[model samples]
Target: MAYNAGMTEIQPSRQVDLAIIGGGAAGVLTAINALRAAAPGQRIALFEPASAVAQGIAYATPWPEHLLNVPAGKMSGFPEQPGDFLDHLLARREAPEATLAEQYVPRLDYADYLQQRLAEAAAASAGTLQVVHDAVVSLQPQSGGHRFQQAEGANWQATQVVLACGNSMRPLPLPAGNALPPGKVVDAWDYDGVRMLAGDQDLAIIGTGLSMADCVVSLLAAGHRGRIHVLSRHALLPLPHAHGGTADFDPQPLLQLPLRARMRQLREHVRIAQAQGLPWQAVMDRIRPLGQALWRSLEEADQRRFLRHVVRYWDVHRHRIAESVHDQLMAVERSGQLQRHRARLDAVLVQDANLQVHGRGTPPFNVGALINATGVETRALGLRNPLLQQLLAEGHARPGPHGLGLDADPDSGQLHDAHGAPQPGLWLVGSLRIGTLWESLAIPELRVQAQQAARAAIA
Candidate 1:
């Protein structure tokens, strides 16, 4: 690896047993698991560009209103130790009550928990675990291992590389030839920037997913009295988790069915559960464990059909909000402070200091600001990350099924080259494997993937 001319003095090339990219939850967990599985003195380097590790875009929020969608009991960093997170909370006196398992804590709290866990893992590794604060820009296959080049021209060689670069926010789907006006539009995750807007400024939020819900909670918490408009193809918000807790149901029988039949079974299950005085969420919870397996069982065409027709509905039901947050959203809706529209955004134009948002089958509307909460871009080819772009361009990796993310082995997470051959020593975890495993995003699935990736890399 060569450094750019006239750049600052480059550091000497470092060697490591494993190199994990991106310091989000996935990366941190992979490092911890790798450290635990590695032999004594095995070097592990985690490359994260941010000043802090494990606080990825999701957990980096400072607002207490941004809470985890999952309950505390299920948010353990280690799958083998299911109560680790709860134990940490108890030890820190953050939530001293033993009954705090069902509590939905702030996302920042989870970030802190993950950071602490990373620190503990580092200490236990006895200087073998190193957190390199730099962005990896490119990767190349070398004679004995892989060479990773950083943004500042530093390079490192590792016998194995785990691509745990999580998710990236999708760019606003603005119409052709229309550029988003600066200062008038913000990413929904920009909590501080969104809160800085005047309370009376009318805001239009694109997409009614979890991020949109978070924005609503943040705006309400900030005492915003603006007329908030939410626009999506189907203006459906996420349902709240059952207050009575999840119920028992069997998803095994439905696993072999096709997409349509499987969905019918799910609907019938929900109906029966509701008639039997159980919340519909119970059925979803039962199916959670089998989500990825069922997804993989589908034919490629059926999988694509599911993505086109069933994904939105599944997401709204599967990923729910906290009951308190749901109540707040309902209160705002009942007070006429919030409005939901079912229309696809077509264009965004700057009309003076305001934004003119055009939608299909609706007249253009003006808003003081627009927030893009359309969620992460799943199509791997469209990502802007230099490393991913280079990897795909050079045939180091290919797009996963349905173009959702990088293509990798479902069991081992070993990356597949453009020609569909598994690339040895190259693994992918977290949301990057969403194409291979439909339920790869959340902690429950990620922890398992982290462990598997570490073991595979070490093997």
Candidate 2:
């Protein structure tokens, strides 16, 4: 009934209860959740421009070498359909042992699972939930409120446009400008670019986060044996996962104390965990919900402080890889094929056949191929992306506070349009929401967000 729903916005026009942008995980998840929250015939459409319509960047990997970082058990998307992905993997013969074990399966399995869900959801709705593969370059509000135009020339008189741009590429701030030699800098997602590396060629990767780990794994899988020097402002690689030797205890009484005090007590608890042969990862995961609640209790400054200081440490400690990948990293380290430098960049210069980046610190920052593994740029709200640029230029939308991402209220998911008003017909989700929702990356967190967004649209 969304397509025929009454207009609650400016002027009279058309409607598609909700128009979600960026067809990746966020978009599809949003569509599915909206379907859950929709009336019998509520109209919804998702736009994803990748090669596959429903399969976003995660599953878009053509190479079988790339693997999902999470275990199959944890990777199952829906909270209720716990073994859905595992079942699909078994049915398709992708992973016979994956269902029972906590093994990290191929990224393709998860991608296929998402595609399967899209197909099932579509079949169930027929008309209510439709998906469009076109990319939305920009959105401009019409004379009436909440009405807008799609960059592809589609007249979208949408009641709400939810921006689910999953992960924005981190800009390469080369000191001498953003130009690199022919084969120097590469975005991690360029499947073809990553694969083209000769087995003998060495590459320099930047950043020391999970994505950096993924890139390292990708290089190893491709048989790249050359030395890799991963440099970053803070060269702290993600912590390893728990050994899972059975240690689960809760802070029964200490949890009732004040937030900061509770945080300290939790750290103390983890120390005890470490002494008891428990993995730090287990401690971190056990404390996640508590951390989130504590985070909410903190003032804005404290939140900003957490972002500046504690978040990275927490990320590495909390979200981790399987033992297999960790072993590979350790092997690379022991073999001296990999080097980590905690150096701050002073300048970057690229010349013929050679790429050089200058930094201050011991060992220094020197490399041939520099991979901008710094991850996505969260604060670029008014940058050069087609849709984002136009929205800011036309005063149709504004960047979120803290300049982290597109601003939206958590309760309503209503986007802050350019006029500094919460636009009912607009929503923002995914990693694009890191500024507001710090724990927005994992599949479980994303599923909840998508469900919330869908429910809000109908309400």
Candidate 3:
């Protein structure tokens, strides 16, 4: 067995007990639990292109102002020890004012926390955990388990493999043959690029979700003070989080109703709760725990209807941002520097030195740059990711409900083949299970899924 101190260049063993395909939070958590549960002499390898583990696109931001959407108390990597993250923060003095569990620390800090946890798990485990800084391009089932091919490494086999590839940002949805200047369009996730934009340069950000919020906050932190145009088909900013109070609201009753009716009933219930001096946040928090079950209760058609009609509203309310962050956004909006549009982007035309963004309902406008923050690329999963493409191209996996993600057994995180047979020794966690489990991407769900997948893999 061989190992390197940091991202390894040491040749991998011919076989490993488990192979995790990504090194983001989900993959790191899965690795931590797998190492803890592994028998002596067992080998686990994690493949990731990033030089460091756990800093997925979400947590790779360098700015201190980019805080975790969830509070520190609830962002623990291990479900059994829910206070682990808070404890780490206190020990490191990362959150000096974090006497309460509600403190929202920097996202980069969370990355550090995961890296440290992974190190601790590796040191304490009886098994060998290899951090392979390589991107796995293809995975195929072999005699006993699966064979993995990486872009720049020796092929290896693993008896159990977990795909925690995480989320892919949707590219700019531009029409074919649209004339646009090169380098004018930037990815919303590229905080380094976004923060470096010339101050006072008018900018247009496409998407009105959490990613957009992140872009806005980053710009403000960087002292960007120019007309910022935020455009989306339905221009809606996420609501702010509210503290205090609990609600005993049950969503089981609404499960019997159709999707549309259920939404209406939920609205009525929220209004009633508000009238009684109970915060809507309390009711929302209650629904969040049962979100997957409620989603599963709906028929396929009803689920589609919910996605089309109600998911946006649910997202804005359910995935609320920190109040402090929300206030900063609102302050910019109130000052007339930040503006939002309810329109669909059609084309980007280069005019003189600026980019003219054209869209329906909203007149054409010129901005120095365009930022794409449209969030996840759910529709064309295979097209965007090669590993996913190979999995779908072959019969190793099939699309999940609505073709949003790969199909997997929600309970065990086991992948299902095209023929609907469970592929033994193969599993997936995090965003890949989005279609099957509506609430599968967050830390709470990912950690649980990681624990389950690890236990199964090691067993």
TM-score of each: 0.95, 0.87, 0.96
Per-residue C-alpha lDDT of model 2 across residues 351-411, encoded as one tens digit per residue: 5566676767845444567777777777755355677777777776667657877766755
Worst 10-residue lDDT window for candidate 3 reads: 1-10
Q: Rate residue 258 of model 1 by lDDT.
A: 89
lDDT at 100 for candidate 2? Answer: 42
Collision count of model 1: 0
In candidate 3, which residue ranges exceed 4 Å CA deviation?
A: 1-11, 94-98, 380-383
Better of 2 and 3 by lDDT: 3
- Candidate 3: residue pairs that collide: none
Per-model lDDT = 0.85, 0.67, 0.86
Q: Model 2, clash count? A: 9
Model 2 lDDT-worst window of ten? 1-10
Task: Give the winner by lDDT: 1 or 3.
Answer: 3
lDDT tens readout by residue for model 1, 173-281: 7756788767888888787987776498899999999999999988888889889989998999989988655657667878788888988888899898898888888
In candidate 1, what residue range of length 10 has the lowest lDDT sum? 1-10
